[model samples]
Target: MTFSLRRMLYEDRYKLILAACQDIRRHREEVAKTVIASQLLDALDVDVPSDALLSHIVAESLLRRIDRNLLSGRNLYLQVEKRPQIDLFTLLQRAIPAVPQGYALANQYLVHAMRQSSTPTLLEIGIGKGLQVVALLRALARDPGKIERIRVIALDPNRTALTEGVAAIDEVRAELPFDIEIYPLVKLIEVCEDADYAHFEALAEGSLSINAAYTLHHTTGPDSDARTRLLRRLRALKPRVFTLVEPSSDHDTEHLTRRMHHCWQHFATVFDLVDRSDASPDEKFAIKEGFFGREVRDILGTSDAFRCERHETLESWLLRLKKSGFVPYPEIELDVDLPEYCRSSVSSGLVRLSYRSVPIIAVFAFAGEAG
Candidate 1:
């Protein structure tokens, strides 16, 4: 079946199952398990609804081995080894447009910086699931003829993330035909402090540019000595452009009104678009309350380091580039449109009650000519 047709059918199935779930007299756990299975199927783009029966059987079998009561509680994670493949990748892709406007702007500036430079090599730090890397690859793939010998390097401490990303790339390799080369560097062989200029020199010897998405925050806290050590190393590498993207909201503030507003808007949209009338209000609420809000809050709340640093701000980061001997350029804006579901999340107080704030910016810098 074609993708469009499959999507329509899946939508109908989702609605049907949701309707079934609303009947409290029915086995709620069974309904929930079936619905979760269906969602996984939809995400995988599997054309066969019959396949979902197998998934349900698998879920039932797994639940039976764990505990009969557990199945009724709708704990699908215990039964599933992997996240629904569709949700995993789709979630990552969804983040692209949600990237704060600043990040996109920085990317444009980096592009301009690369055009002016004699050589352009791209590097991405913290290559999580390769969503951003894929985004970059997609762009390069579009103009394969224009780019000559593009070398993309991704660095991460997690072997699984890199491995999974490489696997994902391999899966799409045929569809995204590009000559651009991607190098996955899964190990940070040495700590930044212990490393000397020679270490950075070796890393940047060939790369003319570098970009990091949500990685720098993980590397060090704003006040930690590690931050300076990492910064010195970054400066030493002397890439033409160094860019970072992080949550734009202020971390110090527990109450972020604007972000809260956005979250509320997001939740409402999700309920309106994704929830079905057949689904019990409780089931729909659980999906929204237990799944979406909890997950986002956990992600955004874990780090104050990204937000605490002055450089986390787009303007401050640009200024730092100049201070670090890189000529600063006018800021560019990424302007990611938050999904309506995200907007709706605000009213739920997930941002204020859970995350404490909302992320809001992207920052970039360009190196000054080598002295």
Candidate 2:
């Protein structure tokens, strides 16, 4: 009897999703389609649907609203751990135009902060493959005389990524005119103790700048107070500047349906950009499936404790920053030219990267003061 009831619930969800897909197709207006999509996703979240049905909803219905090729052969349960490749990360960074643009904006802010001192120390959280650091090094190299030497403290949980990132920075250091030193730590920021932070603070010697790009969202959990406490600790550092780069979406909710809706909206723009990129079809598949598909799976398919991609909105981030004793830094402009598909806007303490009016990524710089 229990098995029969479970089967009935699954079948009902599958049928409801199918009907929602049809309704979405009939609706010509984007707002109407979005409403239907959100409602449908919310209802389906009550009882989890099958992987195949979820894939169909995404490939056939959700992505249709984005004006892109239908995602094919996608599984909701696809495991990202089995396929950890730096190549995929590289492809994602290159294929998405907003990515490099975000990196450039972040580098611009970091370089500006570095200029305040002759020997500045940078402790980058989630220093994945050191892509942003490498870019920052190149930017600093262009005007070498302003700074004498630079020290980079690279931190991330992935040992392989830490190894690759340090090596990349070292290679760039060889070409740059200034002396560069790298201290790579294989640990998550959430787990760092007072001693670890003391070591970090001592290394900076008062000239500290912090950068956490697309990786701080993972530090959001283990508990509710986690992000708050982490931010407080960062405030305690009293760094010269703290730069954060994150996707501007609200998937950090207990409501699975709302989470799914936000996830769909956010990744739709990302996947659409991937489709439009100059990358080959196979490369596109790899990115959408191997890179982003995993993130989608984690957001919708996993429990909150297990979900690492708990992205929040720009508003939530600002509130947290304020509560943690950080105000928006004065310079909030991206003087560098951006891609045609991407446009930037400055708010109180945030710089948003949007795709056709949808907020995609946000770069926030903060000083130790509540505004």
Candidate 3:
């Protein structure tokens, strides 16, 4: 059998690095011991070492920037090599260096919201491998007496993701004495109309706590009424609390140049932080390229359906929410006690953080009027 290699575009370079990072992070020891193939090195546009460290390959790739095609995701490592592909959800878990800190922040809000409920019901959108579920359950585990049982409605388009997420939250059942039940809804919010949300809203059983982490931006255009319509849809759920987590950037412009600049400025700050993180060079590359890098492509590459990654700050999100009948929940700091992983990821940097230094992700808690 003969196989032909796919030609990679310059825009695919960062994506290639993302693939390389995911692969190396998954097989660190193997990469450290062997002389990786010339084909691999050429594929990544990096030099080959006699005994190569994946970290070294990642560092070398970062030295150069892609010149053409701007940003594209194509012929990804798994696609080219036919390797056991990394699940985007699981890879995101491993690739995002600061996600734990972000998750911890969201978990605190989950605890606060659930503590107020008679029977806590959490509706998490973008249930990617159940990362948010883990955070919510962990927070509940910390305060077992707050609620007797928690019902989670996890929504995503992928059934595999539902399976993975259900399995993850199921573990919390063993840790907490309270009954934990997870209902996975396989649907994408992008296509859903106001009435479509009724299905999940019906399952709320009572006052609901809705959590949409990094998922709302994809639901509609930044300036479109669709944004408000979407907000109204969630508001109609009569949520007791809504936990929102989004990137702290405004990449919603129509101008290609403006989008490109915002994309650069945003990821530049992020990549700089990744460079400073105590994570190994390979892990840093993966976080930057595999995880955040894909975001850069999403913002710059296309504006087609669901390819929309329109990010807006907390202030911007609030503007829409307030217009749509959602009001602020009682303000709670809920400062995350950043674990060593987070501390290390943000550590070893000498740059004094000024206006340029900002949190990559922000968490907000809000609520809408009851029906």
> Each model's TM-score, in the order given?
0.49, 0.78, 0.69
In angstroms, give how far residue 54 of model 1 lies from its true place: 36
- Expressed as tens digits, the lDDT of each residue in 97-150 for candidate 2 is 667777788788788888777888999998888878998999888865478889
lDDT of 1: 0.44
Report the CA-based lDDT of candidate 2 relative to the real structure. Answer: 0.71
Q: Candidate 1 regions off by >4 Å?
A: 1-97, 100-107, 115-119, 144-146, 170-179, 188-190, 193-200, 203-207, 252-326, 330-359, 368-371
Q: How much lDDT does each candidate structure score?
A: 0.44, 0.71, 0.58
lDDT score for candidate 3 against the true structure: 0.58
Q: Which numbered prediction scores highest in lDDT against the true structure? A: 2
Clashes found in each candidate (C-alpha, N, C closer than 3 A): 35, 0, 0
Which candidate number has the best TM-score? Answer: 2
TM-score-superior candidate, 1 or 2: 2
Stretches off by above 4 angstroms in model 2 are: 1-54, 57-85, 369-371
N/CA/C clash count, model 3: 0
Q: Candidate 1's error at 88, in angstroms? A: 6.4
